[model samples]
Target: MSHSSPASSASAAPASIACTSLDYVWPDGTTVFDGLQVSFGPGRSGLVGVNGSGKSTLLKLIAGELRPSGGTVRVTGEIGYLPQNVTLDTALRVEDVLGIAGTRAALHAIEAGDVREEHFAAVGDDWDVEERATAALAGLGLGHVGLDRTTGELSGGESVLLRLAALLMRRPDILLLDEPTNNLDLYARRRLYAAVEAWNGVMVVVSHDRELLERVDQIADLRGGEVAWYGGGFSAYEEALAVEQEAAERMVRVAESDLRKQKRELSDAHVKLARRKRYGQKMWDNKREPKVVMGERKRQAQVSAGKHRIMHEEKLAEARERLDKAAEAVRDDDEIRVDLPHTAVPPGRSVLTLRELRLRHGARVDGEFELRGPERIALVGRNGAGKTTLLRTLAGELDAVSGTADVHVPLRFLPQRLDLLDDELTVVGNVARFAPEATPNEIRARLARFLFRGARAGQRAGTLSGGERFRATLAALMLAEPAPQLLLLDEPTNNLDLASVRQLTTALESYEGALIVASHDLRFLESVGVTRWLRLDGGLRDTTAEEVRAEMAGEG
Candidate 1:
């Protein structure tokens, strides 16, 4: 919630990063960006798009981790990038993780009078590197973490902050962060938000964290193989997009009207031309004019009709083009729809009962609680607070240290790793594996509702992007035989893009079964209509979203 400012922004001239006529295609021939021209200058810009939309890939290309197949990517200053998955070596010391181990070692040797010229060279111009590293860690809310401690001792959230601190210590003119808050808790997320707000250089962050996006100076929306810029934060971008969508829809209606009018006019012209030809034929029958004159008149009439036909057809084609362009401007973000009436549990039926449950980590859930009907519970807690362990214990994946977790109905657990589906199997095949009694056609039809239609359903799970894989995994779980009446989801939104998160929320809306979702995303938890909020902190306690956010805000 609070942080001291880092040293001033990069003293170098404001960095400019741009992609010129960029093109990238996967080996399998899936084109992500084609002739995409985008430029970003100094300021915090949040890059957002649907999963599989190449947000991360763009960042990688800009950071020089990946090269474009065609075109030039230009960057002006030093760049530091923090990727979506931050994997720190557990054996490495904190200073090593910060990339200051050599400097610290040199300083120590100099203090101990080693009198080595190499030590003096290594310590050059970094006499205060230790203090700067400490300040960076403290700014990220890891003040208590000692530089000598091993990264293995840090929690998941702490590790993310530590990685971020390492990036900040470099003071890069251009900083690229991709989903930096993926593993962070609410507290750590706030710390990240503060750090983002305090950034003073060219910051390009690709994140689905709404709070973090709210602090950006602008939004670069990468969609449909192009980028659209909005001059403001997330909320502002939404407002601007909503206005654009409304205008686009209105244009579509107008274009449709004009197209219909053109069709009618063309039909009328045809009728009039037919009447004139008949009249001319009747006149010729009566010998009202010379034969040669009649023939000339007929030729002129044909030429006029030809011109009219061409003009009307051109008008219709232009109208159609306008309608198509208008329609393209309006986004069609279809959501996943599912129906599971069979999974419903009656109010009198008990879904889950945890009795004096003690987890492997010594956290005692010494409380008696029963979930009945279709009650949706949100399991919230700080990192290492036993949420995952509790979910695993309830799912029967792990044995509890003591007590019992009784499930009176068929249950399915969608773990954070989403390992339920076989990677080698097709999406339809995977779902069919879970529901052997179902016909192949039936499985394919169900997969369509999960947005894997036609050949998409037949693609191997191993080839699916992260979000698509999640959808397939969820489909397999929900479509499993016996139908899960009680579902346990652990960190469902951890790696999902915002659109995928919305899709998950929509799919859950149709689920009539009891649900327990362990998550750190308060917005997602609230969106799923959570009826009960339970905090797992060595004990199970009923809580509310407001209370949770208050604690995150340092108000509780």
Candidate 2:
């Protein structure tokens, strides 16, 4: 295939951006990027990778927030960036927030004085700015919220949604977003996905949400400081990765076999050399005698030649040993294994039973509800609907000022914030601390089951990404032998990527224990087979999943 010239390619590519031989280094001497090259055009692209694998860094480079230490990053048109955490100035009202952005554009227009009416028309007519902002907010489920509401009053999920609204209103030539779905509830996430599908410009989203990634046309997997672009969605990328890992394993096996064969040959050669040296020594000693010395001269010459051959063989054997060591090192460094342990716990007859449970904080009332379970229940509601509060109360972490609560079983809780873990310890140490009775080998074995093996197990818990830390916590829980009969989880899928979430779902499906989880991830709730829905307000109400879904749809 013929390649286009750089100038032509830049001109012809639609909303294209490129980074050539990019390199970035931290002040602490960590090399985050080295000779990175990536390009994107008009299409849906997903940046998928493990945490701290430079996905966000690469996005920053593309957005021009961070300059490359070496190489060039070029964007042909406007770029909009949605960071993972958007902290809007609290003093500004929602209208003022968008107006400020519009004013900047108007200023740029005025300064240029070359602005056409079409420029303003693109943003809005005389009142176009307001119209555009309203439409954007509506698209993101924030339409019902007043434009005069202070950003400070918004929840984390709401703030994120507003930021997304602002980005959509801007409508840059290329969109760069980091974890756009992180704070969005299921309704909002689905809305965002639909909006992206309808967007005309090139989009590059960095997210761990598998449902979102599955919609992308391509996936750029950042692994080991390099980007590997796969031409299909998450499933295709997974299949390709499986193939690549298999190939790596095959190489390791072949290399090990070769090393073993080389070692054996070297051993045989050493034996032969020792035997030859002994024969030469005996011949030399015998030939040194006076009377037979003349006749033994030929024998002596033969022995001398044999000694030289043995010495050469010894040199070859030494080189073989060095080669074997190198091969062994390569095999050892191939890949890190993740082995997670299965800690299955049986459920009690009545793991959790709530009778006329009413959750209220002063004036706010959630629900007057009742429930009994050995069943998996999903607690879901809007951003501030008290789902989390209800779970906390049920877990006995929160003091219930009213209502009767009954728990007939042991429980383990995995909070959204991971409060269960000590951030200061290593992965292994954290597991050991949690389950002190477990032996070192047993701990390592359990961690390996959770995909924390080798050096990963030794990594500080504080240094681990959200997903890794969660997995470590799960591993620790599994070491409990008789696992907790009841599990209460709060937004369990918050920071987990698509793959990890799927794995977790698979494990939970097979679990025979009772569970009460609060989350906004519809896909996850559906996958884990939630048998009942508990809707939260000022109090808890027993509702079907369908009803909750309808309520959310109406909100949209």
Q: For every model in order, what is the number of clashing pairs?
A: 0, 15
The sequence of per-residue lDDT tens digits that candidate 1 reaches over residues 225-267 is 8999999899999999999999999999999999899999988
Provide the lDDT at 195 for model 2. 81
Per-residue lDDT, model 2, residue 483, is: 61
Return the top candidate by TM-score.
Answer: 1
**lDDT of model number 1:** 0.85
lDDT of 2 by residue, 1-556 (tens): 1111234354455678877887887544558888877888888899987655777778877887777778788787677888865778888788765655555466458558947776565445444555667788888878887776898777567788887777777667789988887656777777888887787788999887777788888998777777779987778888987887776666666666666776666567667767866775786667655656744765775677577666666756765665565454332222223332333444435566565565544313433333444688898767656666666777788876666677777777777667677877888888887787889998987777677778878878766656677788777776765567778888877766666777788778767667788888777888899888876655556788777677556552
RMSD of each: 4.7, 7.7
Q: Quote each prediction's TM-score.
A: 0.90, 0.68
